[model samples]
Target chain A: MTAINPVEILLVEDNPQDVELTLRAFKKANLTNYIHVARDGAEALEFIFCEGPHAGRKIQNGPKVILLDLKLPKVDGLEVLQRIKRDPRTQMIPVVVLTSSKEQRDVVESYKLGTNSYIVKPVKFEQFIEAVQQLGLYWTLLNNPPTGGG
Target chain B: MGIDFTNNVTAGGHQVADQLAASFKEISDLRAALDEHAIVAITDPQGRITYVNDKFCAISKYSRTELLGQDHRIINSGHHPKEFIRDLWTTIARGKVWKGVIKNRAKDGTFYWVDTTIVPFLNDQGKPRQYIAIRADITARKMAEEALRQSEARLQTIVESLDEGLVVADLRGQLLHFNHAALEMHGYSSLAECRRHFQELPDTFELHAMDGTVWPVGQWPLARILRGEKLHDLEVRIRRINEAGWERVFSYGGMLVNDATGMPMMAIVTISDITERVRAAAEIRHLNTALEQRVIERTAQLEMANKELEAFSYSVSHDLRSPLRAVDGFSQAVLEDYGDQLPEEGRRYLQSIRAGAQRMGALIDDLLAFSRLSRQALERQVVNADALVRAALEELAPLQQGRRIEWRIDKLPACQCDPMLLRQVWVNLLSNALKYTRKRDPAVIEIGCQTNSGSRVFWVRDNGTGFDMQYAPKLFGVFQRLHRAEDYEGTGVGLAIVQRVIHRHGGRVWTEAQVDRGATFYFTLEEGITL
Candidate 1:
């Protein structure tokens, strides 16, 4: 969870395969290859808030996009999103809720918590890859996020 | 005291003789009157008949020759006992008169009641010489008296046999008569027992009207009737200290009996006990309240359970689909990354794994959707069936692209239903048609609407490999499928979802199919909705 330099994409996924697939999707898009992975919602919060083991990381040097998985082990992804959206320092950071939930309530709640994008990971790898690539490209190179990574 | 009549013949002897003759004439005339007017008869001192007058013979229905020598016993009715005859004889033998009403029998055996008197004629020695009995006919009066007794007996029998309680009271409110049932109704053993306490009926029994208002004694049935009020179906309540110790309800009918002058002389009241009916109605109300309470409790419990079930299924869909996605995704990724390095068998195995994962994913998603169909409340609106069918076909364009699907659409009517749910029904049924009809070269499929028996019917007919009729019953069940997975690529949830949605709108679904023939599925919406 430690990050001294500014990261491009922060991928918060509990499952290892999902994290790997997400990284590969970025690589295929030729988007920011410098992706940092947080295994659970708790570690994602620690990395973003610079607390616990990430105590010395500067809060301003944040990732360009935070890919948040709704289902997580420790603090729920919704709780993590709420913490970021409520905090003035991390409020402007683009948070994309990338999960395997197609539930309407989940989509609505994620958007209500200020998720920049809500995507249901498709079962087919090709579709998932395409969706992730577009998401990465849009947030990193296409869409101009706030300066200082918000 | 004048002189010896034989030696004292004088100058006035001739005159005295003439006066004596006149007195004799008077005595003979009086005897004739008695003989003609009375039923007269004479008996000797030995109680043998000496003579009978003509009047006696006619009244006794006998001839003079038959009655003259016979004693008075010939006309005796045998109704008088020996002591009665002996009393008459004793008085007559003592030279006193005996008089009594006597029943006498005639020669024809017909009887007559008579007022009789007996007198003894004395001899010079003061001994009885003969007895004479005089009688008068009184049978008409006796018959009238007997008829009155019989009439009273009949009235008593009628009053006692009645089912409803009856009470007759005088103008002064004194109970003159009460029947057997009235005693039982008053919790009394008999009329005498009721009469003992009924004198204070206003104090002994508490009375209330049918509406539970306290009723005064002056307004009671008998009292009202005494005041000449004829009432029908008058209900009242009486609180009794006996017989289950509960208040008894009764209905009474009252009538005032007037004398010949038309003045109210008596009050006749009829009462019927209605305790059982009143208590039964109360029991029904109590049972209804209890039943309603139980239903409310059961509904609340079911609602809570349903909420919990919805939550469980939501999480199951979210948690279960994630693994399937990862499996299918990584499998495809592997095949894409290193397919040439592997042998044919290895690539086939990876493809199989990917296919199985994708199937599992479809099953989980459809199952979740089917569960959501039940929990979603219906939002009924006027829905255009034609528009919904076209939209469903448009959504199925991907499946319909590669196949030669011939569409036979119709101008469908609008229905009052939830548009979203009805659209789902169309998608499921239409896609099912498209999927099952894949092998047909022409791939004939028709979507149309018809009405049968005043109900709206919609059908999706496909001319392709159809199912057996024996398995039609299981067609609409969750995860129930007749075809093999290899033959039909479905999660077995399409028809189930269709059935669920149609049922939510108060409709039903069914399918008709035969082996290797086309299948036609029909659905009916609720009746009488002006569809």
Candidate 2:
């Protein structure tokens, strides 16, 4: 197999405890490459579009997948998802909606906006880690995505 | 001696002749005086006038020349009946004198009334030869007698036809007159039966006094009048003898009419029967009492039915939620714990199971809300629509945060409505707009209001995948979802709850949509409520 560039994952989450759990889950899965974090919807949008504070970053080397939280401050997760999907540069990137809300409307709406998958962050810490591990393994290793070199 | 005797006889005969002549003159003067003192006329027995004296001619208004040859028929006024004239002729022809008041006509056709006597002059064999009639003008005395007869007849007719039983008794209680009605009322056959003193009347009974004690006839109406008392309308009960039994009669008594001097001459009493009228009045009172009792009973029954309905609604709201929670919680547990262990097909089936339970839970919640709305009392307050929309959008922020949506809020008017119920209406409608608009690249949500007369209607519009208009009715029904579970996830009770909340505030909710274009939901906070 030809050598591939290391996979980059972007996690947009507001809660500190949830972020810690997500990092622990990635470590447990043994699939760490390059992992980036954005505390709010605004930070995630800047990182994807390379605008505002993230203007110095190279735009061509964006994250392969975005994990978005529906509830966030400054800018909301749905707006970040819409900005990423609307721009041609970030349109092909896979999006996974990660939320604490189990509301049916949230799940249906996430998928309807072209989210690759939707997962509710469980209240129990162990179940949440397990769900993250499975999602990471499936999307990073098994799924084939179009690679457009920047 | 023969010559001397012859001369003496001749002298005596002459002297006797002279004495006879003096006696004849004295008799002729007496006959003339008799003719002036009496009105006399002589007619044949066939009533033909033969001779009339000067006095008879003067009273008849005729001269002797007219009266001497005319029959009595010439002065007949025709006032007397044929039988009256015939009787006069019969009595005179039998040589008896007949006396009567007769009417005759004068020569100038004026009338005269006369008291007349006709005497037949008879021959030696007692056969009538002529009639001698004596008359006196009596017109003034006859008029007085005729008027007296008419007044007496009128009084007699009134006494017989009176409706009241009238009794007139003397001061000693001796009955003077009893009318026909009075005799009938007292059960007596005639006035003669009551003619005895009231005390002696066989059928008379004692009247009750004011103290309710019996009073004898001597102390009754006649007795009061005799004691110089003027009694009027004294009510008394009289006992009457009837074939069935003795009947009690109500009577009124008063002093009888007397001369202007005010002497106690007689007492009068009148009576009537009132037994049937009194009994009928008592029966009507009894029926009225029974009708009042039935009306009270029916009113109590209606009150009881209203109370029972109130209790039933209370149970519907509080008792149905417990089981619904259990179904949803257990299904969620099964999916979370065993989802990975199950195959893909098995996982999908479990997911469907979880969805169904969740849907059922939502339905139960909606049902409880509907029941609660019926029991909730209205709480009215002023609601600023713009502020209310901001609050509801804040609550729904978690759902729309990650979506690309454009919110265009317009100026809205203040409304009079229940604040809490109005909030529920905004939550349901705005959340539905957010959910359905998720498919769009940049979801556009428009929040605005319009004024219709006195009411303000608020709306939330979305550019999303809308449904067929045919299924619009089912949008607010419990568990009635338009999209399949795989395409869209929903419990479908959100819209239904919204509709119920708006309706409770007397408002209305409606949607307009075209397939795959967009959906707009319009609602008012002041439903049937008027300003």
Candidate 3:
């Protein structure tokens, strides 16, 4: 766990199984980027704000994109989003809502809250992997985030 | 005829001076007797009181000195007209006898009645010489006559002015007296018209007795009273030709007046219209019967609706679960048995099948819950809203664990509501807030009560991804969502159930939000403790 290296993508998810599946998808897609995982909303917040355990982390260094889930232990995905999007330091970071719910409010609320993209996790593991791979390919290698002073 | 006084006196005297003496004695005796009993006075030809006896002086309340030479006018009560007095004077002037009852005034200004007779003495020329006036006291008889006349006048006024149609008839039903009210009540055109019917005793009206029996004249109210029967409030119906022959109800009562011998002399009857009273009683009875029927029908309809919901809920629980369980179990079995042999994609496909079945199972549960909420009878009790909120947070502790959620919970008031049902409301609202605010690091969910615009508003405010105020209308509908499934995990029944619970408690639910700012959902309980 290279904690000091700049994190390329922040995966804010609570389910350990989902985290494992997403990580495997990233690995199999051959996208060898430094991925930082925050198990819940609180950890994600501390990392973003450079507070608590993530005190040494800087706000300007980008995670490139955040793959967010709506359901999380402690603080939820939407709360995590509001903090990042409302702040000048982390507002420009691309946020993609990745969740298993097909609920329409989840998608609409994510986009309305400045989510860059929204994707529902497919029930089949193969489809889920394919979706995650496409997300990684597009956001990590293709999309560019607007840089700003924080 | 003129009396020959000298001839008669000579015929008696020629026989003897004793005969004249005897006649003089007898006349003197008669004069004394008249003086004792009669108020006698002798008036001159000019109507002056020449002499008055002691009886006249006593009856006139005057002394003999005052009566002597006084005119007869002195004791006149002024009751007689000038012509009447003149006639009496003329008769006396002709030496004729005049007799009449006269009212004379005493010296004390009180009146006395007298039966008076005047006789004039005639000279050789048949002219009046002296007049003798004799009177007998008649005051007691005159007073009795006046009293009888006054009593008769008073009786007539009372009989004519009475409001109730008073009809006094003989035992034979012949009318003796009928008041004006009776004439009008009978609808008679004139006294002649009423007299003909009363005298003839015609069959006047078609009438029904209280027992709904046709009444003949023999059983009529007046006839019964004549036969010595006393009746009170004997309800009867009378047919009126002016009313198109429809019968009208009347309260009839009768009493018979009896003579000293206990024989019924006259019959008195009273009639009052009771048509409106009878109709009103009937209307009230009919309306009450209709109201009872309506209540029975509505109760049956509610029972039928409840039975249908019960059947639907039962099938959803049993029949639906069997298929869902089979799908999930079989998929799980395939994944377990073919784990090493099957390709990775095939294994993943089986997992999808299992997940799909599980999702179906969850859908069924949500559907049943929504339906059951309507059928469920509410057991209302005093509920503490703050305690329920705390319990809901505890229930979602797995989601709340490790989360820095700033729950600004305030002191909540107690309200009357179903505790179990309201707790579910709290869970759904809190979880919805938690789900939508997942992206925020330090989620601030404020749960408390407020008085906004004259309402005791209970609200859950969250510093999370709020929705467009436009889409708020769809927030509480089943399966209505504004976010994608990948972002949040829900069947979209949470808010719908919350709305249902609030509505069942006779309250309303609404939200205020700005996209990406925050959301505040407010609700009001049906007349609860104020914040």
Candidate 4:
């Protein structure tokens, strides 16, 4: 991942299988924009804010959207969401919560913390594929981000 | 004795005349003084009145001119018996003086008490010559004495008749009086048997303070009152000496009684038995404490159970679904990627695997929902039943797409319930109706309400494949299905969810069905607002 070809989608998920399935779904949906995978919430934050190993990546070279999972290793998804939304440098990046939990509290908390969307990961492969693809097309190609510098 | 002046005049005429004149002057002065101070009547030896003085006339209410020769019976009041008058006469006839208090009547019939003295003047033979009766008025003193005796009798009666124990003691706390109740309180039948002094009280009875400390003699009711201390409900426990294992609770109140001159006259105390009241209050306090302890213990247990349920639900929601997702996703991956290499049976097997994973996921979700029913706070509202049924029907419209279905939705009453949960109930029951009646050429689903008393019973009747009545008991159990999965596809949790929702709203749910006949599910919400 280089700053020359700016990251467009950041998927913050800990489960390796879920990560592969999500990436496959994005490829099937024909979302050609570069997708960066951060295995946990901490790596996701580092990539978004250009810290640690990702210090060379310019913060302005944006990942247009962040796909967040609530249950993750090290730093959980909600904390990662709070940090991203609170900082002026990455606050404008759209965050969508993607998780296997249909728990009411999780949905309510995600929206309350400035999440752009919430979707429960369906058990059936087809439904999960449809959900990921629709969100990908909407955030990458359909939904517009704010123009100009903060 | 009468002076013999006229016979002795020849013997010593000059000397006798001089002495007689001197004696006459002295006697005249003494008679005037006696006339002013006393009521005098001279009675003859035969009991006839010979001379009456002005003082006597005034006391008898008779004129001197009317009673010069009248007998002494004219002023007799008849208050004295005949023997009493005879005794007085006998004393006077023997030349002695008789003194007594006589009640004499006046001419006007009003009585007067007199202190009278009768003197007999002796002749030469020492017999009665005349009787001179002298009297003094004593009416006022006698009346005052009578009034005092009557008042004392009344006070004694009042003190003795009291129900509460009354004790009167001298300032030194020496017992002077005890009413019957006071004696009974001390376990004594008479004052003679009770402790006679305050110092003896501690020996005869053990008196305890409310806090169970023994009170000494100085703290006793009599001693307290004697010290000029006013007592109110001074409660104590008393156990009489010699009466083992017998105790009574009493309330004592007292005051220092003062004489007219403001000096302490005596100490007065009142005692009342309050054993029953004290025992009842103690029992109530004990019960309250026990009840509070039980409630605290129960609440702790319930909280622990709830925490376990929450942890289980969270694990089910997160960990359980991920594996199912992997199973379904990998199965789909196999079928799609290895399609040309795999035989027909392999593809079908992969499809079954995916179907099985998805079905398991659905079951986990429904089970979580049923368990979550216990945790969800019920939010009650006035809901339009007609709107709830319509919404449920509309949500189930996808099932109605390929079929000919007639909906006979009757007018529904408004109700008080948690709208969201109640909607879940309607969805589950109506969906069951739709699913079970899938084989019908024209599925007829009827939704209506029948109000009984204050509660309205709502029912969903459908012409569908019904089951035997014997299995009706298991209809509301989780995953308790009567029909096979090949015949009617279901996880059999719809009615369980329905029953949970209805029960949470304080309502009842039941069903009526027969094999191959239509089933009607009836439910009554506890509070139904009449519309």
Q: Given the true complex, what DockQ would model 4 score?
A: 0.43
Candidate 3 structure, TM-score to reference = 0.49
**DockQ per model, Cα:** 0.38, 0.01, 0.02, 0.43
Task: Please provide, for model 1 over A1-150, each residue's C-alpha lDDT reduced to its tens digit, 9 standing for 90 to 100.
Answer: 433346766888888877777676656655544578898989999999999998988788777678788889999899999999999999998887876757776888988988877667742335444554656654454353433433
Q: After superposing candidate 1, which stretches have Cα over 4 Å from the reference?
A: A1-13, A33-68, A74-99, A104-117, A122-150, B1-179, B196-272, B278-290, B293-297, B336-345, B402-404, B467-471, B482-487, B503-508, B514-517
Higher-scoring candidate on TM-score, 1 or 3: 1
* Pairs of residues clashing in candidate 2: A77-B402, A78-B401, A78-B402, A78-B403, A79-B402, B506-B527, B506-B528, B507-B527
TM-score-wise, the better of 1 and 4 is 4
Q: What is the per-residue lDDT of model 4 for residues B1-531, given as tens digits with 9 covering 90 to 100?
A: 222335444536878878877877887788779888888888889988888788888888999877877887888888899999999988998889999999888999998888899998887999988888888878777667668888887888887888788888888878888888878777888777653777876766889998899888878877778777899899999988777757999999999888999988888889988888899999999998999998999999988889888888987898999988888877877887787789999889999999999899989988888888889999988889888888888898898898989889898878888889888899999999999899998999999988778778899999999889998999999999999999988888889999988888878999999888999999987764434
Candidate 4: share of reference interface contacts reproduced: 0.52
Which stretches of candidate 2 lie above 4 Å from their native place?
A1-150, B1-41, B51-68, B74-96, B103-112, B119-130, B202-238, B246-248, B251-253, B282-531
Model 2 lDDT per residue over B252-301, tens place: 65666676797645677654444455457657887778777777777677
Structure candidate 1, residue pairs in collision: none
Please identify which of the two predictions, 1 or 4, would achieve the higher DockQ against the true structure: 4
Q: Each model's interface RMSD (Å)? A: 1.8, 11.3, 9.8, 1.3
Model 4 CA deviation exceeding 4 Å by range = A1-4, A123-150, B1-287, B527-531
Q: After superposition, how far is residue B31 of candidate 2 from its true place, in Å?
A: 11
Q: Is the docking of candidate 2 incorrect, acceptable, medium or high quality?
A: incorrect
